[model samples]
Each structure stands twice: as structure tokens, then as C-alpha cells.
Target: MADYKSGDTASWDFEQVRRSQSNSPARRSQSGGSGRRTQDSQPPANRRRRKKRHFNVVTYILFVLVTSAILAGVGWLLINDLCAFNKEDITATIEVTADDTIGSIADKLHDAGLIEYKWFFRLFATVADAKDKIGTGTYELSTEMDYRALIVGMHNSSGNLNSDTVRVTIPEGYTVSQIIKLLAENGVNTEENLLEAAKTATFDYDYIDNNSEDISRLEGYLFPDTYDFYLNEKASSALNRLIKNFNSKLDEEKLAQAEARGYDLQDIITIASLIEKETDGTDQANIASVIYNRLEGPGDKGGTYGMLQIDASLLYALPDHTGPITNEDKQVDSKYNLYKYAGLPPTPIANPGLASIEAALDPADTNYYYYALGKDGKHHFSSTLAEHNAFLNSGDYAG
Candidate 1:
């Protein structure tokens, strides 16, 4: 009976130990192979490391793709900005402050409609090492210029307008009176100021000094040219430039040649001014020959037709005249009337260009004393007044 009790106690204790082992976590994992949790199959450290590595790879690929897209978009915009696709014909003056930077300049350009993009200009300026080379002043910028040209024009004080400036273009054959009117029209000077200066101011040119008393002496000598004038410029300063330019363009050798040809500088100017009004540039030399022929008289092919009969001189004498002269218009009481005077006009009626001056110095060796305007806008030269009258009545002459 003692042995049965001992066996029962031992069996009960063993049964309690088996039940505790089956309920524990390690025993549950070791007992079932296929029924084990997937996470429990591997070590905790290895499983955590694999999950972290997978997340990092996916994150890295997404970051690379997003970054590449951003970079490509930026590159396309930058390339588009640098190209010369946007062209405009706008002219504007940009006032750059001393404290302005490259980025600010880019903004100014963009606002002026001169450039398409501001950020790209700033980037370009930085890359090209031209950011710090810009100057601080009012710059004359035109949209007609390309991007590169605009940058170059504004770089290093190149297109700086220190003061207000007005550009005046003087066309050929413009007289002193016409230039005064032009200066007033261009806002360079007041009409009264310009005319007073022209009439009273004495210039230091050799051409003006010889005939100093006559204010109109520099009429044809003030060379017609394009000039830049300061706003409200002094009339003397404006006229001085014209005189200086005239002196610069006139060659001393050519003046000496004209003096050697039995004519003075005044004579050459007088003849040139007539040639300038008589015909276009192509017929100046031939027209000059006719003037010399008429003056030289019977020794030339021209007989006793001693009158110049230049209608241009007649028109100049009458300031209010606008159209062709009538028979009554020719009777105007002025020494400039070539029909009555039988010589060159008292003074040049207009400013002559270089071609006209050159033509007067070297005339064509022709015996053409009389010329009439033909239907082709060219002069029909004749040796006699009878032939000139015949051409005037013929169908070839429109006037």
C-alpha cells in the first residue's frame, strides 16, 4: 500500500511538469514545425535588419527618380532662357542703382520685356563671371538686341547715359536755317536760342574766320551729319560740333586743288550748293560743267546764253514760295535771282554734301550749257538755248 501511494505522487508531479512545458513560448516553437509563426522562424535581429534594408532601398530609388525629374526640369528651363527665341522691338532706359546686384539687374531686364527669364539671367551671369562687371548708371537698352548683345552692351559702363541725350540726324543739303528748325524739333535746343547762336556766335573755323562778319557764311560749311546732343544743350556748343565736323571732313589737299582751278573756297561752295539743288548725286558732275560753261561764255559750246536761269535760286529768294516759279515769280527783287544777275547766287541757297563739293572741284569736261528736267527724273543737257527750249516742249520732259 506504501509503494502505490509513492507512485501516485510521482506520477502527479510528472504530469504537472509536462503541462507547464507545453504552455511555455519556447516549447510551443519547438513542438510544431509547419505551424510556427513566420517571424518566430528567424532570429529577431536578422528579421529586423532585412525589413530595414528593404525600406532603405525603396526610399533610395524614389529619391533618385524625384531628384532626376527636378534636375531635368531645371535644365530645360535654363536652356530655354539662354536661347534667343523671344525677340521684341522695345526701347527702354533702365536706371541701375549703385546697390543693385546681378539678380536685381535680371529682374529689371525681365520687367522691361527685354529678357524672358530673370533667374536664368542671374545664373548665366554667375557662371560667366560677369556678375560683378556691371556698371551703375542709366543704360539705353533696346529689345531689338539679342540676349548676349544686351548683356555686352550693359557691361562695364558701355551704354551708360550719364546725362539726358537726344539724337539728331541731319540729312544732306540741309541749310543753316533748316538745321536750326531741326534742333528745335529734336528737343536739343529752343528755336530762338539756336537761331540767335547761329546768327551771332563766331566760330573758330578757317572757313568761318575768313568771312567772319557774315553770319550766313558757314551756311554750306556746317557739314550735314548725325549728332548726339545733350538735352537743352547750349546753342554755341551744338553749332561748334557741326563746324568742327565740317573742318574735319574737308581735306586740305582738295581745298588746294579747288584754289588752283581759278576758284576760291567760297566759289567752290557756291557752285557745289547750286549743283546740289540742280540734280541728284548721279548727275552732279555734268551739271557742274554746265554752270562753268555758262559762266565762261562764247569760248565754250554755249553761245551767248549768259543767264543762269536757276529756278532753285529764284525759290530761295522768295521764302514763302512752295511750288514751281511762274513768269511773274521770276521778277522777284533779289540779287539771288540768277535770271537777272547772270552769275552765281549771292550766297549758297542750301548746304551741299561731299559728293556735290567733290563734283564742283572736278567738273565733267562737257560743253553742256543748258539742262532741263526730263520725264525719267534725269537732266537732258544741251549746248544751246534753242535745243533746251525744244526739249522742254517735247514729250520727254514732264515739267
Candidate 2:
């Protein structure tokens, strides 16, 4: 209790005082002497976080290595089967018919040992966007062919879509008989076999009406286009291909048009056949107008009396129609003779090309009831018989 001002210089043991303060709980904690460990003086959060980071890094590396191994193994399996690698030299004759789907064809290939896995092939087909590219035919495949080669080979033989194919171009106004003759001559099929197949083959078409008693039931349906047929192919197959092409041309748009025009496909085709035989391509739409006027329009006056008196209609009855019509030909008692029938023919006389078909669907607006081939190789339409007679006497043709 002595006052510091009195300046007492008596010194005690200072080391003993420091030792006594050090033993206290508050002093020990403050000086880090470890009476009881504080939160800051214990193992730090940063050190624990560093250990966790190291563990996460190891885990990420292991994950990447496992994923890479799995990917590599998967790629090896797909490539090996896709390329037919390490396969023995083998040959398999696979017949891909029109009825075969992706699954059926894959099954066939797998059974023949030409492929290993059907599911993988289906997946490849889906990825390649070739679910509908494979064609129908008997293909000879070898173990050396890869996935690309297999698809290319089956799509069209000889690795070309049209190579090694017999190209047959049917004219615009070609009859069924002429088409059969041309196809037969081009080594597509035998004429006798094609004739029989065409007459008897039951084609499934919603628009076709097979009510006619004729040797060629597919008269007007054989769309005139350049087609590539396999050599010595099945007659039915070739016929079906032509029919399919025709069906494709008459799409939903065309069908809607026909319905809008109040005309069915048969009527359109029959009228188109006549237009194809009459028009010289210069005034086809006008000729179509003349035909429409004569059939059912204002031009159906005393000029035609709703009797499309087209001389081309008589040609349908004559199988050997080489020259122009005569008076005797008009007397023929066939439904095809417009002079006797007073309406359209029983069926289309010939297969018309797209031009004539379009003209029939969309005719030029006119009052023409007659069209004559003039000397200028163009049609000269006339609304009256006097105008037609004048053109005939004008020396436009041999008439």
C-alpha cells in the first residue's frame, strides 16, 4: 500500500511474479500457453480446407480416367463391328425385298454373319439418317465391305445409283404397248412376261379403277419418265416401279386440285391423254382449253353437243394405228370412238407426260371448241366450224 510517489526502490523477485501470472487461465489463454486451447489457436480452417481440396483433386483425376477408359472401349467395339474388322473372308447373298424393314434386314445380315450386332447397326442407321435409303434387290456382300460400302452397294449395285442400269425413256404419248416394247428391247424384261404381268398384276391404288376389259390395264398410269431399271429384273418389279413413280406425281396437292376441279384422277388422265395426242407443245394449254370447252363448257353448243369429237379418241381402239383416221375408223363400235360414244373414252389412250397432265388440270380460258395443227407446227384453235374449215382450206396441213 506504499505510494509510488514516495519512490520505494525495494525490488522483489520479478521472475516469480511472471511465473505466477502465467499459471492463471486467462493469462495462459492470452499468451498461448495452452491452459485451454482457443478456436484460433487450434488446427485452422484453412489447413482443413487444403486437405479437402487435395482429396477432391484426386477424385476428379480418377473420374476422368474412368470416363476416358469407358469411351475408348466403346469406340473400339463400334469401329471393329462397323468395318467388319478381323472377320474371315466370307460371302453372303442377302435379298432385301420391298417388305423388309431396317430391323428385318439387320436380322438377315446378322444371321448371314455379314454383321455382328443388329442393334448397333440399327443405331448406326439412325445416326446416319439412312432408314429409308436402302434399296430392294439381291446383293452379294463380302466380309471386306465396311458400313459405308454395304449401304452404297445395296442402294444401287456397282456402287452407282444408275450405273449398270438399263435406262428406258418412255415418250410423252407412248402407249402401254409401246412402253412394254421399249422396256423389253432395253433388256429390262421379256415382252411376253411383261405383258402378262401388267395385265394380271393387282396394283394397290386408291385412285385406280380396273373395270376395263383390256390386255393392258395400266394403260394411262405408266408415267412417262426416264427410268433406270436393273438388267433382267422381275417384270412385276419393273411395273411396280413405274406405277410408284406415277403415284408419287399425283401427290396430295394434285389430288386436292383434282377434287377442286370437280374431276377425278381418271377423268383428268383420260382428258390429258387426248391433249397429249392433239397438242404439238406450242399451244398445249389452248388445246386443253378446246378440249375442256368441248367436254363441258360454253363451247358445248351445236358445235360439239357435249361430244368431244376428237379424232385421237379413235386411235385408242386401233392397236396398229399408223396413219390418220378415216370415215370407216369412226364407224368402229368401240367405247373409245368419241364419234360413237359422245363422251370421253373408256380409259386413257396413252400415258401422258407432266406437261399434258398439267394442261388438263389447268386449261387456258377460251371459247375454242376445235384445234387443228397448222403449217407452223402450232395449233390453230377455232370457236366455229367455219373458222376450222377456213384453216383447213388455207393449206396449213395436208387436209
Candidate 3:
């Protein structure tokens, strides 16, 4: 009765009382299995000290950042002024070589008083993708040109309207003679000099096959594009500029893709030229597929007996000849006559545009081995000789 403690352990025996508390639920929860303490069970002074240390670290970081920002504001004003504004309205001559770097170009611009900071120019050139676009050329630049205009003015070929420049556009499928004639008429060079350069000048490009003794040796290599040439420019320089621009378009990715398809750049260009002349732009991919299917044939795989049978290839030899191909014309004894030859022509028939080149590389997935121009100004393709003959004889091609 004495140890009852109102039937609880609130009794007077100290040992009994301590033992009872040790077994209590609250005591067991705080002690856990080995009497380890949680963060909340730490001393108040120790917890406060840890919180004060964390606050000091954050405060120090903020203080340093604020001080640095204040100092950086003054530098920003100077950088902005130098990058965005300029002085002097004088003109400067900038010469960029083929192997020039952005750092070198920046140094030239700075020396010419066109830019105040070289680092800024380098940063801008990288960010704007002008690192590779700015090619070898001599540019007469005025100080009034902004950063963007300066980049454009220094490009190897462009339509930038300026003094000492004339814009000339070489269209797709134009022959070498036509290209030279067009450039001459535009006053870029004399026709006599251009012809001599075409005949004699040496181009160091690897893709130009120099074995051919044909007068128009650079027939298909001159890429078609709009260019702003200097008035009275040298014939070799103008031609080289065009050829270099063409070379730049054939990157490693495209070259690898051509190799994977078992064709070289020259072969792809030849096929593209045929496609360019075969049909209007509407059925380029389909015609490309048909050409591929036929070239793969002479059997169950390629059904056209390994002959291209293209009429346009024949016309390339006769400069003045025009009109549709006749049955008798197929007998012409020339390498350009695809009906008589089994493989690609000696060279490309004409310069092909990017669209034709793309179609040549990625032809549409199809079973077509024959195509004929319909009355609707589109090419109708067929997989079988019977279906192709039916389309030709039916003459109900209006649709």
C-alpha cells in the first residue's frame, strides 16, 4: 500500500523510482537503442552557435558580390561604348587571307580604326557564326558600317551594294560559256581575257579533274549563285572566287554521305545535272529515283539495261542545237550520248543547283525505272516497260 503511489510509481524508494522512469515510453523514445540524441535534443547554446555560423557565411558571400558588382558597372559602361559606337568617318582597306583567324582579323580591324576592342570582335564573330563565313578577300570598308555590315562587306562574295562592286547572278544549269558570257556582259572582265584564263589558268582545287583537254574544262565546277564582283576584276580571280564558294558547300558530312551511297562528289554532280535537264523542278526527286533505279538495272534489279537514255546529255555537245530529241539523233557518235553509253557522262553536262544536287543525293523511295513528261507539265513515272509504253501511247496525259 505504501509503494502504491496512487497505484503509480510516484513512490519514495529512489532506486525503484529511477528504474521505472528508464522503462517509460518517452524515455525510451529519446534514448533510442544506444541513447543517441537528435538535433532537437541538442543544447540550446550549441544550436544557436551553429545557426550564427551559417548566417555569417551567407552574409559574407552577399557582401563580396555587392562590392564586385559596383566595380563592374564602371567597366560595363566603357565596354558598351566601345562595342556599340565608333568615331571617324574615314575608309579603311582590310585584307583577309584564306588562312586568317578571327584574332588576326580583329587585329586588322582595330589597326584600321574600325573597332576599339579586339576581344569583343572575336566574341561577336564566334556567336554570329561569322568565324567560317568570312572568306579571303580585300574589302574597302567605311567606318559608318556597323558590326554586322562589316562582316557582310568582308564576305568573299555577296550582293552588298557598294562602290566598286557589280552584282551578277549565274543561273542554274548554265554552261561554262554562258556563265563567262554573262560575267563579261556585266563588265566584270573582258570576254577575251576570261576565255584565255579558262584555257590556261591553273586552279589548285583537288576536285577539278585536269586530265580533260576540253576547252570548257571548268564546265560544271562553277557554282551558280549571286555574287558582287569588283568592276574590271581579273578573270582568274573571279573564276576562283566562284569555285571556292562551290567547294565550301561540300562539307565533310555531305562527302561522307556521298561515299556511303557508293558515289563521289563528281558522280553526284553528274547525276544532278541530268536531273536538272530532264524535267521541270516539280518531279526532280521522282526523276532522281527513276534514274537510280535504271542505273541499278539491266536485270530484275535495274530494268533499263544499264543505259541512262537521256536526251539532254546529247544536246550538251551541240551548243546551238535545240528542240526535242529525234530517233535519228540518238545515233550521234559522242560520249555525251547516254543512249549509246552505259555509265555516267565524261563530266557533268551543266552546273546543277542545290535542289537538284539534294535530290540526286536523297532520291524518293520508289519502284519507278521510267518517267515521261506528261501534257500537264509533270513527269509520270512507271515501274514496268508495259506500263511505261501504255502511258506513252495512250496520250491521255492531260491529268
Candidate 4:
């Protein structure tokens, strides 16, 4: 229906229009290809994220395993070594020398079967820093104690070597000779050595003056009391201890009391010995008064009244006198026999107690001249010789 020019025909050709319409479908296919490339990139990104999560899980598992292994190793070491140490059980005496080193003591412990392993003890000591802390002494170790306890015991210094010493109590009133005899009998000293110690030792000065012929002899001066000494003590040591005890017991007050009285120390001792020999009852002061009165009173026979006629003193004078006194023995003449001598005996006959000594110094006031024991163990006193003769003749004292 329209005439076309040459240029218009070139611009609107039918074949070219058909070709262009087909190219539109090809361009739409290229756009759809871009969406498929985007989907592939998304899959690659998700795979990287999953790989990172898997790596984190492995690292956490390894860390937990390593920590558990370390803890288990520590527990095993503690159970095997530190918790098993204990003392060995054995009966052995461990003598620790003075200022002994830790190594030496450890060796001794090992020798005594007290420790199973000496090195273990050393290790414990090292850990506790107790090398110098261990004491030096005798120790009685038991197997029942742990190693720690044994160490503690050594540090505490609890055991001694001389645990079984013999204790002897020298009672009050024992003479030096008697004490020496006791020492000999008890195996503490020899008789010869004891006698020599008593003689040469200063303890015997109380009995004999320095210038006198009698050098050393202790009679009543050895105070009697219990004494304790080691069985191995020397005789001289025993004597020294006895002297020390006497010095302690004899205070200044008692000495002053003796001096205040008119009697010298030895005289008071002599009277006390006489009083002890004559009486047994609590009325010793009364008996003491009788002896004092007689000393001050008139004599019995003549020539300054030489005879005291004490029956006990006569018995002392007899050489073989053992049993009761007979009437015949009283006639024996000896200086010790108060019946023969004028004053007190040469020395005290026995050790006298303080009470007897005090009684001798301060006798009760009485006028009686003679006294005889009755059948009832009581004394009958008289002022006149006729009364005394009658009382004796009555035979009421036939004890």
C-alpha cells in the first residue's frame, strides 16, 4: 500500500526485524545464568563457615584432655610417694651421741631397725627442715610410730639412759657407821672405802676436835633420813650427800637453842642419848627432869657421889652383853657405866631425836630423887631413900 525509498527499505527490512526479535530470548538466557553463579558462591561461603566451627570443636576437646591428664599425673605422684611414709616396728635402743649430725642419727635409726629406708627419713627431714632440730639423748623407739612421729619425738628429747636407778632413803637417826654398813649391804660402796671416806672426810669433824687424838668418827651427828643415790655412787659421794642432808636439817635456830641452854652441843647430845635409852613413853621430859635432879642432888655413897648407877649405862659397859641385864653385870666397873663414872658417858650411845634433845635441855620441874618402873609400865617416884627402898622391896615392879 506504500511506495518505499531505498534508505527507508534499508532501515525497515523484514528479515532484520525477525532476527532482532529472536536475540531478545538469547539476552534473557544470559541474565538467568548470572543468578546460577550467585547461588554457587553462596554454597562456597557456607562450607567455609562449617570448616571454622569444626576446627573450634577439635581445639576444645584437646584442651580438656590435656588438663585431665595433668591432674591425674599429680594425683598418682602424691599417692605413691608422700602418703606412704611410716615408722618401722622394732625393739631397739637408739643412743644418740651428743651433738650428733642428722646423717649420723639417720644411720643409727637405720641400724636400730627403726626406719625402713634411711633416705626416706632424710627426705622427710629435708622437707620439714628439721636437721638441727633433732635432740641428742637416749631414745626408746617403737615401730608403731609413723616416721613423722619419730621425728617429732627426737625433737622433743623425751628419753633418758639412767631410767632404772636404785633409790635409797637414809632415814633420820642413822649413824655414819650404820650408813656405811647400809651402803655396803646395798652394793653402793665397799666397806673399806666407806670407812676410809668417813675417816678422812670433813663430815666427821662434829664428833672429834681438830687437835684431839681421835681423827674422824661420826656417831650421833649423822642425821637420819631417807636418801637417794645411784647404785654406782662412790662411798665418798654417799658420805658427802649425808653430810649435806645433816647441814640442811640442822638449822641455826636449833643450834641457838642448844647454846642458850647451859649445856654445850656435845653435852646436850649426851643427855639426849641417855634420855632416849631410859624412856619409851611421851613423858620423856619428866624422866629427863629426874636425871637432872639426880645430877644436882647429893651423891649415893661418898667422895663427891661418884656413881650414877644407871642400869642402862652398866649394860653398855659389858663386853658380851646381848640380852636383858642381870643383877651381876651391874657390878662390872667401866667408865661407860654411869654407876662407875661421875658424869655423862664419853660420847652419845645412839642418835637422839630433836624431841629428846629438847627434853634434855628443858626438863620438867620436880623434886623426886629415885624412880622405878611399875608392873603397868609407869614410874614410881620418891624423895627419900627410905621411900625408894620400900618401893623397891614391895616387888610391885616385877616386870
Q: Of the candidates shown, which would achieve the greatest TM-score relative to the real structure?
A: 2
Work out the TM-score per prediction.
0.57, 0.66, 0.60, 0.50
Error of 3 at 95 (Å): 16
lDDT of 4 by residue, 230-317 (tens): 4434455566655555456554665577577555777767777677767755766877777776776665513235345666666555
What TM value does model 2 have?
A: 0.66
In model 3, where do residues sit more than 4 Å from their true spots?
1-163, 210-215, 298-303, 397-399
Candidate 4: global Cα-lDDT? 0.63
In model 1, the worst 10-residue window by lDDT is 155-164
The 0-to-1 C-alpha lDDT of every candidate, in the order given, reads 0.77, 0.77, 0.78, 0.63
- After superposition, which runs of candidate 4 have C-alpha atoms over 4 Å from their true positions? 1-176, 204-216, 247-261, 300-306, 331-333, 378-380
| Pairs that collide, model 3 | 297-302
lDDT, candidate 3, residue 218?
Answer: 84
Which candidate leads in lDDT?
A: 3
Q: Candidates 2 and 4: which is better by TM-score?
A: 2
> 1-399 in candidate 2: lDDT tens per residue?
755732343334566676688567777668556466666655578779989999999999999999999999988878988988888888998887767888898899889888888899888877764543466677888879977777766763312223256788889988989989998899877898788778776666765544543555687799999988876665766777787788888756775887787778888888889888888876778888877777776543545866787887787788778877888888999988898877788788889988888888888999788777767777777888887888888978545
In candidate 1, what are the lDDT values of residues 1-399, reduced to their tens digit?
Answer: 345677898999999998898668877778465665555445678888999999999999999999999999887765655665546578888877657888888889899888887877877787765543455567788767666766665654323445467889887888788888998898766888778777778676665754454556767877887888765655766777787777776767878987886778778888888888887669999999988888766744434455778888887778788877898888877888987777778788788888898888889999788888888888899987688889999999978
**How close to the true structure is residue 275 of candidate 3, measured as C-alpha lDDT?**
90
* Model 2: residue 364 alpha-carbon error in angstroms: 0.4
Question: On lDDT, who's better, 1 or 4?
Answer: 1
Task: Write one digit per residue (lDDT tens) for candidate 3, span 1-399.
Answer: 344445354454666877788678887687666677666656689888999999999999999999899879857744553444546776899887757888999999989988777887788888875753565677898767767788877764322222366899999998888898999999877888778778777776877755654546786788899998876665777888788888777657866887897888888889988998886887789988888887775546434576888888899976678776777788888899988887788889988887888888888989888888789787888888888888988765643
